[model samples]
Target: MIVPIPPGERTYRAQQAFEFAGSDLAGLVLFDDQLIQYFTGFIFIPTERPIALIITREGERILFVPRLEYEHALETAQVEEVRSYPEFPGEQHPLLFLSEHLQQLGLRRGLIGVDHDGYPPVMGYSGPALSELFAIRRVSAALDRQMALKSEPELSLIRESARWAGHAHRLLQQYTRPGLSESEVEARATREATQAMQAEMGPGFRSHNRWISGAVALYRGQIGPNSALPHAISINAVFKAGDNLVTGASAGVWGYLSELERTMFVGEPTPQQRHYFRHMLELQDLALEHMRPGRACADVDRVVRAYYEREGLLPYWRHHVGHSLGQRIHESPFLDIGEQAVLEPGMVFSIEPGLYVPGLGGFRHSDTVLITSRGAELLTHYPRELEALIIPA
Candidate 1:
């Protein structure tokens, strides 16, 4: 069962949606089959087949679902009108039914904003075809751009999620040992996260997949030139006494998520591990120190790259400094050279700097951060300092 969003929250989301469409007279039509999996809330389930449609205009909202699910939609979703299609004859298909319904509602013309990219084509009416029939112009990139900025309520949800994820990480650290398999450590982390969410927000706020826990225990193995390469799943190897365990956990509450990653040494670390760990931490601090309003994301990247180049560790450092996080784990406003998006208040992103040495393993530290007027505020408060867990050999 999904929890109902407060009326005020719906109104806030609707306002943002209107701004995103770039018109005061815009409507958002989300087909039932759309993969709004990233959207936080229980009103809509993740579906590969379109079975629902949501239409929103200035001061008006409507939702259309199959007759059987009409009651559920009304109870869970926020909309002015909840309608079903069983009443219509000759058209069992939802798209055709919706088109006819829109015509009846006098919405057959003007600018209609359909989430073509967000919805599944098989279940919903194609934006172009609908435009041809209704003489409506489809708005592109408007909705996505609007969703990038986080509102107060949205930020609150994200902060809560991050808090739970931090607790999970602490539990994981306590349970980790030299002999523990990567899978075992990951399982414990997932359990910790699940318990945290249930304790804080209730069972309604649970993840659909194990991957949502986003807890990965990467044991020391071979490192490569590309630091991001170790971030891949296959690189998670066995644990040893002197190995560095790079682990992170991500938890989603309502539809918002916070991701955290850190490097932990098992027992005592070798000189090489200690050296690279300090270097990665330094790089992370540098990225954080450079973050501020009006600063180009690309400039932050350049500073990080310059530091690595000066230390002759450029090859090990690959990928961007970090990226935006919210409803989606990876959103827009990426921190890289090609990105020209200026830093703005209320914007949240991650700052992860890593060093990978081939045949030796990897070292990385990641935290979700929010860009404020004065500086960046770190959301994930787990320890990232160079420390060794004294596991009995």
Candidate 2:
């Protein structure tokens, strides 16, 4: 049976990060929304207003937010103090309040480790850098390294996420038809799968996104020739009988996520389509065979690119093999040509090697994988063969 993340997970993260920051620093200040959630388990919408989490070397945790989030922070933030300012760009700016609070916490004369120099300049709000107000050192890479490696509890959530994503993908296939618009099909399938998830997971389960309460599976406009563009935006185009479609599905289990994507067809595929689909599967197989513990991330990309080049399909290669995923959809240690990070046990990756033929369609499959001591463990259980993915015209 799958278990939810332990209640003390956030506290453990905070303690580990503080230990990594060392005693020389006054504290560690996190301005990134994902980092705050990683360290505190307090999920909040990121907007023009900035929120911060401060962890002192003494293990004291403090959270600062706007007055609008004061009650929410008090109830949700895992911190000793939940301080709030009136608003953003108020007479006393939020940063000023943060500075004063830091001083009150005895952080006047020492260096503080920060994820970024200041609150990210998002949504037209700009202000003085944290360096302008206090002494700071950038330690974002250290945090990234810590978050890249997953523990047993984190993997449990991701495993659960993959299970729901597979269920949603099955619904997406069952709901697809030649005459319906992509949005109509997606809406019907997502609603039914979400209802099923709610029934099965019980009331204690909650999605990471405030708007989406359960699993999501979508085509994202990857229909017919539009699928040739790897990142095609959804235009809600209608499905056609002979259309080659690409689809994606994912679900958030308390901020942990898993990716599952596939290339499928609305009806029987042509001979050329079958050839490309088989080649795409072979390329992905080559990459997966090379993915093992202690292997460099770049090696996987290199192997896949070599196969594409040998088959004269390099022009169709649009992106890298895949990327790591967890609290965010995309994370570090990417399977790219230049990444030097070695594959280690506990690192989870989305193994996707895609080929997009212009004016034809895209053929690709993505699955979540975990690096184990012996080899890689596949997490997403969706069928990959073309025969299994075909839909009736």
Candidate 3:
């Protein structure tokens, strides 16, 4: 269900959106309760309900929620008006109600901006309805352009989230050893993430269960080369000595998340594993160095490709450099060819350079970074240092 946001938070977000759009106000429609819940940092609870929002140019906001959720939305939302629709047989559909409300606000025409991508078609009535009632023109790029830059508060949330992820990684490092099942390590990591969030951010934060695993072999019943990918599911693979372990630790603080992963050797890494890990780290650094203001995103890809080709590692560069990150795990400003958007300050993205050698598993180092006027700010702080996680052969 859509819980109402505090008026202060609503004002802050609305004002930020207005500034980002370079306009008086941008109308945002939070049609899905789940989206609203996550973006608003509300707890995820299942509900067969829909919600709508109208943020005005002057910072006044309104919410349209189902009758059952009216009180909850009122309490949780930051908007001034918390209107409700009865269970059934209402005078008008929710869309029409919203249209009327917007019309009443005297926003039926003239430079009203919206985020078509954020407000999917399924979430609200088609543009035709809105267009019929108001002079609506699609300002498709408005929200994404605004969201590209992270404000201080947004960066604070991301930094805190990264801290929790670091804590989770530490827990994984301590618990993982030879003879332990992949599921066991995953369980411990999940527990650590959950506990860390609860303690750090209180009840509003929750960690999703996820982990990763892989290996070489064991000798003398000790931990072996371990290679663990951050797996969100159970893995039956057994850990052994000399195996390489790669794991990603991710934790959500409020609705924000920070992810960091490392490659560790159960005992000592083989020459091949160490080489691959080093290359992956280098690629990560290369991607970060190439990120700058006004550089074409496609140019970023060219630099990565050139580096990989120079090292005779082109075939291993499976994915693009990175993608934008925000309320959604992956958003726009993709680091690839054909993306024309110039790099701007306040944009945040992941520069995850990866290499997947067939039959050898995959090696990827990902970090969420904010593009600043100076350069990129790395959000994840966990050490990427390659080390041997000795388990005593």
TM-score of each: 0.82, 0.96, 0.78
As a whole number from 0 to 100, the lDDT of residue 203 in candidate 1 is: 48
CA deviation > 4 Å runs, candidate 1 = 1-5, 24-26, 31-43, 51-53, 85-92, 121-140, 200-228, 234-237, 388-393
| lDDT comparing candidate 3 with the true structure | 0.62
Model 1 poorest ten-residue lDDT run: 32-41
Q: Candidate 3 — which residues are off by over 4 angstroms?
A: 1-9, 19-48, 88-92, 109-112, 117-135, 200-236, 241-244, 388-393
Clashes of each: 11, 0, 34
Backbone clash pairs for candidate 2 read none
Taking every candidate in turn, the Cα RMSD to the unseen true structure, in Å, is: 4.4, 1.6, 6.2
Question: What lDDT would candidate 1 get against the real structure?
Answer: 0.65
The residue-by-residue lDDT of candidate 1 on 90-187, one tens digit each, is 24555666777777766665556675533354433332245545544444345555566677776776677677777777777777765666667667
Ranking of all candidate structures by their lDDT, best first: 2, 1, 3
Top candidate when judged by lDDT against the true structure: 2
Q: What is the C-alpha lDDT of each candidate?
A: 0.65, 0.88, 0.62
